[model samples]
Target: MSDNKLWEGSTPFKEKSHLFKYRNWLADNRNIYFNSYEEIWQWSVDNIGDFWESLWDYFNIIAHSPYKSVLETTTMPDFKWFDGARLNYSEHIFRHAQLEQSAIIFGNEQGDYSELSWKDLKKKVASMATYLKSIGVTKGDCVVAFLPNVPEATISFLAVNAIGAIWSSTSPDFGTESVIDRFAQIKPKVFITVDGYFYNGKPHDKTTVANNIASALPTLEKVIVLPYLKKEDVSGFPKDFIDIHTIFKTDGGELVFEPVDFNHPIWVLYSSGTTGLPKAIVHSHGGILLEHLKYMAFHNDVHKGEHYFWYTTTGWMMWNFLQSALLMGATIVLYDGSPTYPDFYKLWAFSENVKINHFGTSAPFLVASMKNKIAPKNNCNLSSIRSISSTGAPLPYEAFEYVYKNIKSDVWLCSMAGGTDVCTAFVGGTPFYAVYPSEIQCRALGVSLYAYNDDGQPVVDDLGEMVIDKPMPSMPIYFWNDPNKERYKASYFEHFPGKWRHGDFIKINSKTNGLVIYGRSDATLNRHGIRIGTSEIYRSINKIDTIEDSLIVNLELEGGNHYMPLFVKMKPTYKLTDTVKNQINGLLKKEYSPRHVPDEIIEVTDIPYTISGKKMEAPVKKILLKMPIEKSINIDSMKNPESIDFFLQFAKQI
Candidate 1:
């Protein structure tokens, strides 16, 4: 790796960080001291139970009852954490209600802005909770929302948790079938929705979509509609529909947090549903409370009263994660429209206007901005921004360099990788470490992350499966409707037997202790007998200005023949000429090996992505491998469902 340090934590900056204070707390309270992050991380993973148990006191988590053991079990599919402790996730969120900063600040594509103060937020949550209970919803009941990334969604989630009902949501941009595939499985008692939303300067009316979704779920008792769109009313909705304004119209209810067991389900996050019905991964209230507190407080180094913003829809896990900043008394910022609404620089202008301290976005957005040459530093006052967080995919080396060169010189850039399996990131950033190009700063404390080879041996400086030998509280309590958790076991445990084999292929650098993610192991481009990550090929492809996006898949045909083709989406003005193809091949061969070059390079209109902005390489591979179309991918879960049609027609030729 290059010896380039983009940013360094100074003496004062480190001293003021929450991680520094936590380190000091360990020295005083637990008699634990370490000079380096590696030492602290080692101690944490070595003593996983003690490390997590210490967070109970450090975060001062409010528990109605005390826990007996740090962890009750030690193995997969049966592991238990903090047995017998009773707490509430919503309760911890309200602890910061007394802060002077606004609890939620929202902006939309129509240039509309609004703020919800802590006092107002508490009142609305109480009102919504009262409405929920009035409709016979109670502890363990499910409440789902078809809403955007607005304050109302936050209010609805808090209210559901306030009364002990489970919460799930999808951004209204999702198709009706996609929403039904998720919400119908949960059998929600209350369905919350918005009439519509504005995106890219256009109005998307989902009133009909909401009614269709509500009608499909026979279990839904009440439908609550928020009249968000100026053009539409709830006139077309089904009967028993209640306006959200009515709930707030009679607002005299008191906010109450219902304490549940340590491992009780608080929210259900879904798998991409690329293949089948999305797996409803359930997280415990206490588990999420601990994980979020640790991640936001220590890893993010967020301070109270600071503005924290992540551009996301309610559908993505990052939306759930964004709200956790409020647990640290930071003002959480929300944006509802497309990131590139009038222009690519829309979010940067919003950052200037809102004075965002911590800016969070996907790696693709940063890469696209770099490609478009949209310089934020030239147009906006980004001096208030301290850290820029990127995830959703591996941040390329060039993208990391572009941020330091174009955005700001001294900003803390964090490149993290995690998935819906666990809402919190296994590997992310820490204040104790210096910023490294194209490397995740460190494995999160207590994550017990390791890269193991095909023989299940942990390897340093070599690529392997990302396995977790120990359990984190944040790991899913159980998947909804997964009998005996068979699907869950088959998803994570079947590969490594007691260890969780996260699908990603990653390597931990022996010298820097930094991790570099290659790509998903399931989608590895196995060239003949030599295996390499698709990212290794994409790394060279991204450098070619002609290619906008690409996907590579290896098809194992009969007689052990391998056909790996690279499908690239060209820029509007460029065509896939012979020179462009040769440029792509020459770079891949030069950068990696000749094996990195694809057998064929083809052009496509667009590449398919999950609704949450992930490359759909595995699903596309199945389609081209002659799997039945319906079983191959759930089209509703795709960002561009039409993009899959090109592969379906090509499948017959194969």
Candidate 2:
């Protein structure tokens, strides 16, 4: 493929690029010589110890006890990073805090905005920490939250980490069973939750869910509730529930930062759990601290005093990633309510209102905006946006073009691909590289990533499994309650022994070295003995004007027969007629192959997506095969669980 340079780094950006600065530092201090980014990347991976040591010095990581070695082992799952280092993740965050700067700026879909200065944030965190300590909470205790993306959630996380406690959280929208299935595995001592929340301009009372969760988890010593919607009475809550304001009323004291070991658990993140219970993946303090320092500074080019915003909930890993911006001295912008509520232009208007320097969102949001014909350039002043990051799914080429045409032409539209597994992007954009349409700029520094064929050999210019040949600092330390390391090994290392198989179908361009992610590998569609990515079909279908969103599944019957059905959610004005079906098939045939056409075309009210905005293709395929709905997926994890009803009825008819 040709080099489709959508945006090039400006002269000012080149001067400020972290890659350039790091190169200059290397040449000045270490006497290392590198001419290009590829050389630098190769050097970083080859001399892993030196590269990480340089990062520790470059970021001035505040470690109470210095590491004896940068890496203890290079093994995949058991790789130890910065062993013997003792540091607090929250301490690094507070180090960048200045009294005048805003640590967090928060808003919701209702246009309510608030700011918390660094000093105010520290005071709130200190008060909460003191309260936790008073309640007998100590180091290594699990503090799970069922809160919204509010200031309190940020403060709770900071307090939990400050005291060396592990933090885990889910959005308030999660159902009782879904929340229990995750939190019960960890058995958190303190449960922090909200009484209610608003979405799509309507208030949703989550008191029942919280009550049920509190009842089921016996280990919860205290349930602290925040009044978010103010519609419910706290008196109706369980007797064990306590008002969060009471905790804040405590006299504030100096914040205590507990220095934990390098591999100590800092937080517990969960997998989608479509097949069964979500895996409680654990990440460490030192691993996450160093990884985010490299990711935000070098890859994202986020700098001090800049405003960084990501449209995400507390449940998503991006929320955790967004909080790390505090370590860089960048103000994090938080939004709690629906992104498209009131209008499709809400987020763009929000970007302008806060003067967002770096904006992050999913690919589906951009596609929806493009289909809705909402042009931000015509309505909003987006001059402050220097970079737009897209993740959660593979960005279609049309979406990439739409961003430049309708949003802002001079911005770096970085199409990134990674997942909750690492809590960071393996392939993303760097300021030194030019933005290529629909392609991740390059492999992240310190991530030894490669596309490997089914035989576990590396390949280029062909779709294969995305694998990490060498370990990185940010890989999950272990899964909660997964003793003997059985589940942890089965998740990634089972597929290819000693290598981290990420389970994503991807290809690296031979010419540009840029990465293009197809859909999930297990969800790839096969027709006429030829394997094809579902994203290829979605890319073609999204070009049609009538279709808003779609889902496709391929089935192999017991007999020598195969079936492929295409389900589409159409625009309000359009109908699924023969002409539209023929148009879709024709586009697939012309752009892809004759085998790419679906056997049947149908219309649906909605498409099922994970709460984090990923298509539920694997679970939907199981539903089509007459699998039990409960076993097929966790309904609470879906954005629109009602959408699954259409597939259930269709399955009965078939």
Give per-residue CA lDDT, model 2, range 1-654, as digits (tens): 346678889878878877789889999989999887778888988888899899999888888998888888888777888889999999999998899789999999766889999998999999999988889899999999999999899999999999999999999888888899999999899999898899999999888888889999999899999977783468658887778877787777898899999889989999988778999999989989999999998888888899999999999999999999998899999998999988899999999999999999999999899888889999999999999999999998888889999999999987788889889999998787777777888998988889998788889999889998888888999999988889999999988999988889999987787888989988888675777899999999999999989999898777768899999999998899999999999999999888899999999999999887889999999899898887888887888899999998898877
lDDT of 1 at 55: 94
Clashing pairs in 2: none
Question: Residue 146 error for model 1, in Å?
Answer: 0.3
Residue 168, candidate 1: alpha-carbon lDDT: 98
Per-model root-mean-square deviation over C-alphas: 1.1, 1.4
Instruction: List TM-scores for all candidates, in order.
Output: 0.99, 0.98
Count steric clashes of candidate 1.
0
Q: Which lDDT tens digits does candidate 1 get at residues 1-654?
A: 456877888889899999999999999999999898899999999998889989999999898998999898788769899998999888988988864458888898889898889999998889999989988999999999999999999999999998889999999989999999999888999999999989888888888898899999999888899989854467877667888988976774778888899998989999999999999999998889899999998899898899999999999999999989989999999999999989988999999999999999999999888888777888889999999999999888888899988898889998898888899899999888888788999999999999999999999989898999999998999999987889999999998899999999998988888998989999998788887987788778889887899999999999999999999999998999999999999999998999988999999999999999999999999999999878889999999999998999888888
Residue 627 of candidate 2: its Cα lDDT? 89
Instruction: Please report, in order, the local distance difference test score of every candidate based on alpha carbons.
Output: 0.90, 0.90
Best by lDDT: 1
Clashes of 2: 0
